[model samples]
Target: MEVFKQHCQIAEEYHEVKKEIALLEERKKELLAKFEQAEKEKLDAAQLAREYEALAEENRTLKLAQSQCIEQLEKLRIQYQKRQGSS
Candidate 1:
C-alpha cells in the first residue's frame, strides 16, 4: 500500500511538471511574437527616417530654386528702371 501511494504521488508530480512545461512553452511563444513585432516596428521607423531625410533634401532644393528666381526678378526690375530713366 505504501508502494502504491508512492507511485500515485510520482504520477501526480509528473503530470504537474508536464503542465508547467506546457505553460512555459506557451509563454515563450508569446514572448517571441512580441520580439518579432518590436523588430518590425524598428524597421518601419528606420524606413520613415530615410524618407524624411529625402523630403528635407527636396525642400532645400526648392528653396534654393525660389531664391534664384527672386534674384532674376530683381535684376529684371533694375534693368527696366535703367531703361525708363534713360528714356
Candidate 2:
C-alpha cells in the first residue's frame, strides 16, 4: 500500500509538470509574435520618417519659389505705376 501511494503521487507530479511546461511554451510563442510585430512597426516608422523628410524638403522649395514670384510681381507693379505717373 505504501508503494502504491508513492507511485500515484509521482504520476500526479509528472502530470503537473507537463501542464506547466505547456503553459510556458504558449507564453513563449506569444512573446515571440509580439517581438516580430514590434520589429515590423519599427521598420514602418522609419519609412514614414524618410517620406516625411522628402515632403518637407519639397514644401520648402515650393515656398521659396513662391516668394521669388511675389517679389518679381511687386517689381513689375512698381514699374507700371512709375510709367503711368510720368505719362
Candidate 3:
C-alpha cells in the first residue's frame, strides 16, 4: 500500500511540473514578442532622426540662398533709383 501511495504522489508531482513548464514557455514567447517590437521601434526612431537631420540641412541651405537673392535685389533697386534720378 505504501508503494502505491508513493507512485501516486510521484505522478501528481510530475503533472504539476509539466503545468509549470508550459506556463513558463508561454511567458517566454510573450517576452520575446515584446523584445522584437522594441527593436523595430528603435530602428524606426533612428530612421526618423536621420530624415530630420537631412531636412534641417536643406532648410539651412535654402535660407542662405534666399538671403543672397534678397541682397542682390536691394543692390539692383538702388542702381535703378540712381539712374531714374539722373534722368
Candidate 4:
C-alpha cells in the first residue's frame, strides 16, 4: 500500500511538471512572436528613414538648381538692358 501511494505521488508530480513545461513553452512562443514583430517594425522604420533622407537630398538639389536658374535669368536681363541702352 505504501509503494502504491509513492507511485501515485510520483505520477502526480510528473503531471504537474508536464503542465508547467507546457505553460512555459506557450509563453516562449508568445514572446518570440512579439520579438519578431518588433524586429519588423525596426526594419520598417529604418527604411522610412532612408527614404526620407533621399527625399531631403533631392529637395536640396532642386533648390540649388532653382537658385542657379534665377541667377542666370537676372544676368541675362542685365545684359539685354545694356545692349538696348547702347542701341
Candidate 5:
C-alpha cells in the first residue's frame, strides 16, 4: 500500500536525522574541550608574561646599581691620584 511505503520513508528519514544529531553532539563535545584548552593556554601565557616583566625590571635595577658602583670607583681613583700628586 502507498500508505505503508510513505510511513516507511518517514521512518527512514527520521533515523537519518537522528544519526546526524548524534554526530553533531559528539562534535560539540570535542569543540568544547578545545575551547577549554585554549583558555588554559591563554592563562598560562599571561602568567609567563607577568613573570618576564618582573625579571626585566630586576635586571634593569641591577644594571643601574652596577653603573653607580663603577662611577664611585672611578671617582675614588681620581681622588687617590690627586692625593699622591700632592704628597
Candidate 6:
C-alpha cells in the first residue's frame, strides 16, 4: 500500500511539471510576436522620415525659383518704363 501511494504522488508531480512547461511556452510565443511588431513599426517610421525630408528639399528649391522669376519680371518692367519715357 505504501508503494502504491508513492507511485501516485510521482504521477501527480509529473503532470504539474508538464503544465508549467506548457504555460511557459505560450508566454514565450506572445513575447516574440510583440517584438516582431515593434520592429516593423520602427522601419515604417524611418521610411516616413526620409520621405518628409525629400519633400522639404523640393519645397525649398521651388521657392528659390519663384523668387528669381519675380526679380527678373521687375527688371523687365523698369526697362520698359525707361524706353517709354525717352519716346
What is each predicted model's overall lDDT from 0 to 1? 1.00, 1.00, 1.00, 1.00, 1.00, 0.97
Q: Which regions in candidate 1 have their CA more than 4 angstroms from the true location?
A: 1-3
Give lDDT: candidate 6, residue 53. Answer: 100
TM-score for each model: 0.82, 0.71, 0.83, 0.85, 0.71, 0.77
Error of 3 at 82 (Å): 2.2
**C-alpha root-mean-square deviation, each candidate:** 1.7, 2.6, 1.7, 1.6, 2.6, 2.1
Say which candidate scores most in TM-score.
4
Number of clashing pairs, model 1?
A: 0
Model 2: residues >4 Å from true position, as ranges?
1-10
lDDT of 2 by residue, 45-81 (tens): 9999999999999999999999999999999999999
Error of 1 at 36 (Å): 1.1
Error of 6 at 44 (Å): 0.9
lDDT of 5: 1.00
| Model 2: per-residue Cα lDDT at residue 20 | 100
Number of clashing residue pairs in every model?
0, 0, 0, 0, 0, 0
RMSD of 4: 1.6
Lowest summed lDDT across 10 adjacent residues in model 3 is found at: 31-40
Question: What shift in Å separates residue 6 of candidate 6 from its native position after superposition?
Answer: 3.4
